[model samples]
Structures are given as structure tokens and as C-alpha cells.
Target chain A: MSGATPMLELRGLRKSFGDEVVLDGIDLSVASGEVLVVLGPSGCGKSTLLRCAVGLEPLDSGEVLVDGNLISATARDASLRQRVGMVFQSYDLFPNRTVLGNVTLSPMVVQHRSRSDAEEQAHSLLDRVGLWDKRDSYPSTLSGGQRQRVAICRALAMRPEVLLLDEVTAALDPEMVREVLDVVIDLADGGLTMMIVTHEMRFAEAVADRVVMLDQGHIAETSDDPPAFFRDPATPRARAFLSTFDYRRRSGRASGSLTKE
Target chain B: MGGAEILFQGETISRLLSGLMVTIRISLVSVAISIPVGVVVGIAMSSRHLLVRAVLRAILEFVRVMPQLVLLYVVFFGSATAFGLDLSGEAASVIVFSLWGAAELGDLVRGALASIPPIQYDSAYVLGLSRMQTFVHIILPQALARLMPPTMNLVSRMVKTTSLCMLIGVVELIRVGQQIIDFNRFQYPTGALWVYLAIFVMYFLVCWPLSIASRRLERRWAA
Candidate 1:
């Protein structure tokens, strides 16, 4: 990889809700085409970090940058903020719109693209995610996995520089998790830069180029080698977090690649 | 003269029909003004600013607590005495009802906007849609579905509430019915009962379709 500027960067991020601090003086970066997975227990500020990164949550004291240019964490600059795309735990699809409408709305409305061009791109993105046939269906008609996939399609349609996933599969049923995760895995394989927050240990091990374990609003451990970190975490907090999941037993299956149907 | 003969009295039926038209006119005019104004106020009511929310809440409470008849009196009689404004009964009724309808519909709009989950905003914002664009394309469309049933209910209420305007001497439906009954008191003994029954049916005819439409929207959107 060339030694160019990082695709995304967070500097001295500090956030507090009332007296309780959620993120504390954290600094991180995702280089171009890197998949950096954030591993943490609930309430460790994983979701908030992603929210702040995309300007959904205002940082108390921090700067978020895209391609080395400072963007506001307060969401003052919308066009600059659009460089990042995010998918949430709950598939927050627009219930009033059909799948096609949801995918094309931003491009047509915000970016002012022609309807023909937007629809053309939307059809291709939906087709790639296996949702082209359901383009006319409202979000209420789709299953959880299908809805999440459409959400991914919606984000990808924007052609964001970096995509953020905030425990996107946490709300899915066990059977549906793989279908959604498979889409993320495919995105990673295609070299899309991403910052993912997840509890899915096996998928994290498979996809992460680097791993950061956050505990109690602080980065407790950072692993440049994901496989080694999974095998032997350097910090007790990181080890305990991994122990809660059946990481060892699932280690064998981590090597298996997901084939797109 | 029997009740049938009283009904065919000189210009009686035509007068009552015109009075019903007045009632429809007042309600329709108020609704037209209320919808757009209420929608704007409702969005303002959902603002995060404490002062904006508090002030709007105060206005909403005032409108809700005061009876429509009292409002009519305040605008019609009070304006004439206090401000030297000799507003006609029709104009006063329009002013009073528009204020009342706009306030009620504004509260409904605020609730509809608040009912939307915050994630919807996040979804739109991350896609680079401005706050206005988000509200228009994403938030407003979802809120409208939630807003329609209650809004229809408000329209029906406004239609029925127009009966109160006659208290200000609007000579609307009820006033017309009274004039008819009083004119035939000596000849038609049971004229009062028939006239009132007709007025009741007229009010029902105007309001019932609105109620049906409200329920239909509620059912379809609920699904």
C-alpha cells in the first residue's frame, strides 16, 4: 500500500453524556481500503464512536477527518460528512418508500443526480445484493437480513469513501446474521475501506486487518495481527471479552470463505 | 298548517340550504388556513430549543382549554369593544375557528413528527441530506401517514364545531332552523321538533364521511 493520507481519522475524541464519559481521548485511523473492526462489550462506546464518526453524535472535544481534511463532528458540513456511510443495528429503512426509492433518494435529492442515472446505479447495487427483484417492495415487506442488505445497498449507492457498520447484525436472527455479514465480507473482499463495530468474533477474525478492543470508553488494546490477537490477547480485558464468546471452538470455521450466491 | 305545509313556506327550504352552505364555508375556510399553518407550527413545536417548545406548548394549551364558543365571543364581541374592529359574524367565525383548528392540528403534527424514530434522521443525515431535505423526503412522508387519521378526525370536529358559530349570530344552519320554527309557531305546533331533526341529520351528513375516511386511513396505515 502507498504511504498516502489515511482515508479516515479521529483525533482526541472525548464525549460525555451528563457526568458519565462515553469516549475518552481516543485517536484512531483507517487507511485506504482497510477493514478495522472494533471489538467491545455493550456500553463500551462502540456504537457512539461510529455515530460520532458519521456526525450523528456530536463529539465533546474531537475532530473527524476524511482524506486528511477536518470535518465537523457536530455535522455542520453536510457535504464533507457524506464521505462516510453508516449502517445501524436496526435496519432504519424508510418505511414509506419502496426499496428502489430508498436507494435512490439521496443521490437524486442531495446530490442532484438525474433520475435515470440514479435508478441505473440503484438497479446495479440492488442487483449485486440480490434485492433487484424486491426493488418495488416497501421495507415492511422484507425480512431482517433482506432489509439490512438493502441498507448496505443504500449506503453503497452513495459511493462513500469509508463505510461504518455499527453492530449491524446484532438485531438479526441467528439464521439471518450470515446473509448480512456475507455482504460485509464481500465488501471487504472488494477492498472497500470500512470501520466495523461488532460482537461477531468469527467474522471479526476473518475480515479485520486490524482490531481495537475498547473498554469503558477507552481503547484497552490494539492488535495489528488479528489472528494472533484472537489466539492470545495481550491484555486481560481483551482476553476476558473474547472468552465470553466461544472464540476457540469457532476458530476453525473462521478460515472458510463465504461464497456469494 | 301541518308540518308538511310549514316546510314549503316562502323561501324556508332555500334559506336553510344557504345556511348549511354558510356552515360548510366557515369550516372549509378554517381548514384550508389551518392545515398549512398547523403543519409549520407543528414542525417548530418539535424543535430541540427549550424556549420554542415551551412557547408552542403554552399556545397549544391555551387553544385546547378555551372553548370554541368562548373564542368566537372573544374575537367577535371583544374585538369590537376593545380594538374598534367591527368584524362581521362570518369573519369572526373564520378567525376563531382557524386559530382553533391550526392549534389542534399543530399538536397533531408535533406528535407525528416526534413519533418518528431518531434513527430515521441519522439514516438521512449520513446520506448528506440537509435537515430540511430530511424532513421533506424522509421524515415528512412517514409523518404524513401517521398524521392523516388524526387530521381527518380534526376536520370532522371542525365541521361539527361550526355549529357554535351560530351563537355569534352567524345565521348558519342552527340559526336558520330557529328562524323557521319561530315564524310558524302559531300554525305548526310540532315544527320545532322536525326542524331540529333535519338540522341534526344535516350535521351528520357533513361529518359522517369525514369519520369514515379517518377510520379507513387508520386501518390502512396500521397494516
Candidate 2:
């Protein structure tokens, strides 16, 4: 009955979409203030793992616990999604919203925070993401980086126990990628628990306190020091991924260019 | 009022302006009702239930495939006679037009919602938003942005369709023009052409700004 335990725990998580088995039995946990990075190639189930963890996708089997409340179980009772926040690869900004409006929408609407209070919090978060200048501008008007940054603020405004970042920077350009990762790294510095699914080995190596390597829907290996993990992968899948990634890596390695139309 | 001078000369101009007003009235009501109705239907179409989707699909296809005039006659006259309902010409046109608007706008809404990349939805889920939160704050806004241009274009079509209400004996602008020209056949037998031209221009006037807005939005959002 610890009040301040780890924010999330995934035990034997399994999921499938129709006939596609997207997540096999997986086990993972995140302390309230830890930053865990999930790495894998495309279609390897990293994104699916994040979605299942946050209750976005129903799990075929196993349990997803957030702040010790069950989000999904073996019986498929998904109910703990309220405290886990997520950021997607595409930012998922409200196109009908100004940057500030997007940031504060949930708080003012769902949480019933007073408009002034929500605006106050929104402005502060927008300032944190360096988007205050664009607060009045719509998502359709901002650059990719700016919009994604607004998305991050939108996540932080909810005061979630855990934040799930699914390749957020994978859609940004090189320079813009740094801008977003920097925000995430700063959040880590401020003790936000984050489970990030990403391909940015450099960012992973630089920011992750624990690096989890997923391969074909299973956790192949996990290590405490990301630099060590990236430099010396333990599992064959990790080594293979590392080996392949090093040969033809893109220059600048930013996320904005990654989500090219 | 404006185009009659350009398209036709002499004493036939007064009748056309009156006809123009009818076109504007029908379009305004139909367009207003269509917006919210289409949004709800579009969202319903994305529902998971097979029965709901099947019913909505049937309604949409029925509206889409059948001619609007036919729908008008059926919903207006056929249903009214069978159910013993009272509907004036204007009332029938508005009711029929709303249904037509619902089907068309619903599809436009579906496309608008579809245009949003899936990544955005992923973001909302990860942000701990409940399904309703995601729809209101995230999905609805993005959908609304994409919905604007198409709905505007739809307003133009709705405006044009009001001319068809002449068959229903609505005293809208086109009917007014036809009635006037029918009475004043001695002015010129060509008065029918003049009257129709004027009615068309009034529709153009009412729907022109909407078309311009639609074009501007399309250009701004073009890939």
C-alpha cells in the first residue's frame, strides 16, 4: 500500500489485432521518476506496447497497472487510463485550436479547471515548450516542431503519473528533433516518469536512464546505463539492430524529417 | 437585381429580384441545419456497431444515389400523404433539403475526419484523455478544420438546389420569377429565360462568398 510507488507496471502483456499478434507476453515497470526508453525496428511491436500500456489498445492477455490501478487485465478489464499520458509520433494536435487552446483543452473541459486557471497553466507550459509566441496561432500555422512541442505541453498539463512517448520525435526534422528531445530530457531532469518508444539511438543513449530493447514483440534485453547498452548490446536482437542502424544512418538524425509526407 | 440588367433588358427586372430572395432563404436554413446534423451523423458512421453503421450507410447511400428532386417528392408528398402530415411548399423544401444536406454533409464530415493523420489519435490516447476528451478536444477540432471547406462548398450546392423547389410550388425566387413571367407573357415570350437567369444570379450572389472561402481554404491547406 505504498502511496509513492512506481507509476506503471506491465506484466505478461499480450495483444493482437484481428490475426496480427502485435504484443506478446511482456514484463516491464517504471518508477515514478524514471525515464525508460523502448527501442525496436518498425513493426517490431514497440508502438503497440506503448498503446497497450496506456489502455489505447486492449490487451489480449496480461495486466497494465498505472499508479497501481489496473488499466487492463487478463479478463480484459481496461480502466486505469486516466493517469497515463501519451505523445504520438505525429503530435495529434487539435487543428481547430490555437497552440494555447490545444494545451489547455482537456484541463478546462474534462477536469473542469477554471478558464483562468487553465489558461494560466497552459501559458506556463507553452512557455516551457517555447511556444508562447505561437500560443494564438493555430496548429495549421505552426512548424512541425512547434506543433509537437504544443503536444508535449498538452500532455504535461494533465499532471499524469506516467507519460508514454511513442516516437514523438520520429516525425520531426533534425534541428526540430533536438528541440523536442530537449523538452523531454528537461522533463526527465525534473523527475517525470516516461516510457518512450523511439528509434533515436543518440537521444536514447543520451537521455535514457534505463534502455529496454524490444524485438519482434518481446523484450530482448534491458540495461541500466543507456550508453553502455547502446555501445555494448547484450541480446542478439539488440546487437543486430545496433549493427544495422550504424551502417546507413541518416545525417542530422532529427525527427521532423522522419515523418515526411 | 444585379444580373438581370446584364442578361436581360427592360421591364422584367423586378420579378427576378423577388425570385432571388427565395433562393437565399432556402439555402441559409438548409446550410445551417446541415452543419451540426452532418457532424453527428459523420461521428456515428465511425461507430463500432454493425447495425448502426448499416443503418447509417443505408440512409447515406439512399440519399446519395437517389436524385434530390425524387427525394423531395417522396419525402415531401409521398410521406405526407401516407402519414397525413401538413407541409407547405416552403416547409417541404426545407425539410427535404435538410435531409439532402445531412447525407452530403455527413460524407464531407467523414472525409474531413479521415484526412487527419492517425498519429494525432495516438497522441490523445497517450495523453491520458478519455475517449470523450479525445473526441471533443482533439478529434473534433482537427475534424472541424478539415470540415470547413467542404461544408462551404456544400452550401453552394444547397443554394443551387433551391431552384428545384420550383417544382414543389414554393414561392422562392425562382418560382416568383416563373410566376411573374407566366403572368406577363405579353412583355416577351423570352421572359422565362430572363427570369431564370436572374434567379441563377441570386443563387450565385448568396453562394459566391462561400465558394471563395472554400477555395481560399483549399489553397491554404493544399499539400
lDDT for residue B214 in candidate 1, whole number 0-100: 88
| Model 1 alpha-carbon drift over 4 Å, by segment | A247-261, B1-13
For residues B157-213, what per-residue lDDT tens digits would candidate 2 score against the true structure? 888878789887877776777676777576566556666766667777778899899
How much native contact recovery, as a fraction, does model 2 achieve? 0.58
True contacts kept of 1: 0.87
CA lDDT of each prediction against the hidden true structure: 0.91, 0.79
Output the number of the TM-score-best candidate: 1
TM-score, every prediction: 0.90, 0.83
Tens digit of per-residue lDDT, candidate 1, span B147-220:
99899888888888888888888989999999999988988877887788778888889989998998898887
C-alpha-based local distance difference test score of model 2: 0.79
What does the TM-score come to for chain B in model 1?
A: 0.94
- Model 2, A223-256: lDDT tens per residue? 9988888888888788988887777656866656
